[model samples]
Target: MSKSGNPTLIIASFFSIYVIWGSTYLLNKIAVTELPPFMLASIRFTTAGVLIFILAKFLGINLAISRKQFLNTVIAGFLFLTFGNGVVVWALRYVDSGFAALEISAQPLIVLLLMRILQGKKIKLMSMIGVILGIIGVYLLVSQKAIINQENSIAGMIMIFMCMLSWAYGSLFVSKADLPSNYFVNTGYQMVTGGILLLLTSFIFGETWTSPMVWSTPVQYTMILLIVFGSIVAFTSFNYLLKVVSPEKVATSTYVNPIIALTLGWYFLNENITVQSMIAAVVLLTGVYFINTKKKLLIFSRFSGRLSKKLK
Candidate 1:
């Protein structure tokens, strides 16, 4: 491929990640209807883990790891998939898919803050401003419902936010840990470890499984497709994009996911998308763009460039 093709590939890969992942929130909502929350998440990761491992094996990918690396990978799985995505799946029971997406979309902000506090890195002022704006946007999204219903969907939202932090931590671990060079191999390990842990937790929590012969048959198939396409294909392609694309472009996926989730929720579940929700989306996207593209903010970028370089 020509050098020029590289950017195009990156852009395309990013679009894929954004659009595909955005839809997963609705997928979770649908899948959870037929499957118990924990079991549903457990099955999705396990299937993805098994499939990815088989594919990696077929492609001559190595799965072996040092004792330290193995432990790190397992711990990573617990943090990332277990705590991050697992909580989102768990919360879908209590929130709309669109709402669930908006809540979890707080991820970039959480990641930014976590990196600063945990890693002793400084956040760019513009990024900090962006986080503030994004938080405000989230507040707007739920403000009316909060006032009208007097319910604390705040707890559910906080769970998803924590999901973001755990995911960020797991990602940091992946970057810093001593693991095999092959990305697929490492991912397979993480998936297997994470999936098994989720399964064990499901058992401990008494999650029951049902046969395929159910009216909500789509849920089972949805979970399968989600694991196969969403977890495996979308995520692996995301890694490919990060390798080839500018971080700014890849980060755009964070903004795009809410749109995808909202549209999918509308189509599949007959969910309503209100004007206020659209406003919330705009605010969230703007905030995320600001946070992720702090380089464009000039002075703040200069101050935080060293820290940015380390996180990236």
Candidate 2:
């Protein structure tokens, strides 16, 4: 970690991700209390995107993108933000934020599966075990809670599951696609594209910004927090980490964020946490750890070789 970058900056960036990104879930719940999910998210992302773009321009960053590149950014944005983020916010209406975060924490497992299916990569034995454990963890997490907030927890889990899939594909696509060199600028374009898509989607769903006049003080603050800390600060930190540290190290945030979100939900919203939920969190995060770690122990390498020989 020390060799990766300035040790202080790395610690600060990790802290930003661990706490700020984690808190976004709770903030989303607060915002959705009064604002419709699509409209709220559109506002959040658009404002942040525009601001970031302007800042990038002021910093003399190249903002030029070709038509094809722009379209890729748009498609990636729809996958990453419109579908990925919008659904999570919408599901918050039906689900506890903690549960939703846990579902998202299983994304590494989903990404591994997608890599195998879409790209023909072989799934290693340890990674296969990680995927199975992730599935079981999610099953245990959602089994006990059938309904929440008068909506189906099963449906919420399904939506969040889709969110993970969208993010997984979006990330994979972005990695292969032609994107801007500057991470901040690329992210800004994606955000703006997603915000526009969400705005159109809001109209399609007949979602009106009818509650602006009646929006609570807390809701307003929640929106500000999301735009400032959640979108700007935390996202910048994440991008910074990607540039300076190994992605595997940064991936640990998936596990930490859920723990922080669960604690906050229980502390602030008085959300009930069962023994099963705790155990499931442990299982899910452990699965994520396995998927993220690139190092192979001798046992797994030998076992994989033996299995391949037998199969051949």
Candidate 3:
């Protein structure tokens, strides 16, 4: 890879988002088995946040910022990490990581619609079709009856949808916000603020949190892995990506993650992927693909309104 403009870094960043973040879903699923959802996230963010800040200062990355920027970054963190990621942790108690992955894959579709609403971007007709298909897929996936889920699945589905929604909104808002010129320094503040909020929420909710030493060995390892790889490494890569690449390009990771999660969940966690889930995954992912790509793509999307009209 040419080092011109650090293309390698970009590719590596994308890979990190795809593989590392993808795996985090399963990692989180495992961690929450013994750890409370809020606290699990608190630990990951707080540790990662502090480390990022220290590294930034050590590297001579300036941390100075206006009050407005600080508030915006932290608020974005609260929305994305706290409400978005935090809720997914809670939902895992009822939902399988694979199922949650499928739901989270809808992030691109949600972001597309949010951009149309928030930024006045004109969405193509085929993109609308894509969005509609994604909705149907998610509905089918969630509505299909499963013995393991019982009734909590309904609440689980709702919470995961909220996670997607919160994450989508955060992405949109963060793009528009002015933060530190250095992405690492800016992200550090967000993580710290978000982690603090999560800790406070854990306290308020009385989550029956346990000390890490008391947790099982597996949980301990998972927590450690999340802090190091998932939060610090993947998040730094993601922040770098946001600064360099088109948001649409970065969003492609959403498509990849669910597949990784589904495969890992089946292989390691033995989570069931029903016929409905498989079909849902295909439909949902295909729709998301269309939403991200231009008018020229696999069959159906190739004839998106503009192209069809041009042909006619």
Alpha-carbon runs more than 4 Å astray in model 3: 1-5, 147-149, 295-312
Candidate 3 clashing pairs? none
- Local distance difference test, each candidate: 0.74, 0.82, 0.84
Q: What is the lDDT of residue 117 in candidate 1?
A: 80
Global CA lDDT computed for model 3: 0.84
Per-model C-alpha RMSD: 6.1, 4.3, 3.4
Q: Model 3, poorest ten-residue lDDT window?
A: 1-10
Cα lDDT of model 3 by residue, 1-312, tens digit: 111237898888889999999999899999888788999999889888999889988999888899999989888889878888888999998888988888888888888888888889999867887899999887888777673347587888888888888877877676667777677887788889989999998998898877778989988889888988898888878767766765666778988899999999999999988988899988998888778776445565555666889989
Alpha-carbon shift of residue 115 in model 1 (angstroms): 1.9
The lowest-lDDT stretch of 10 consecutive residues in candidate 1 is: 1-10
lDDT of 2 by residue, 48-140 (tens): 899999999899998888888889889978997799999899999888888888878887787777788898988876777778888888888
Candidate 1 segments exceeding 4 Å error: 1-13, 146-152, 213-215, 239-251, 299-312
Q: Which candidate is the best by TM-score?
A: 3
Residue pairs with colliding backbones in model 1 are: none
Off by over 4 Å in 2: 1-15, 146-150, 210-214, 237-251, 295-312
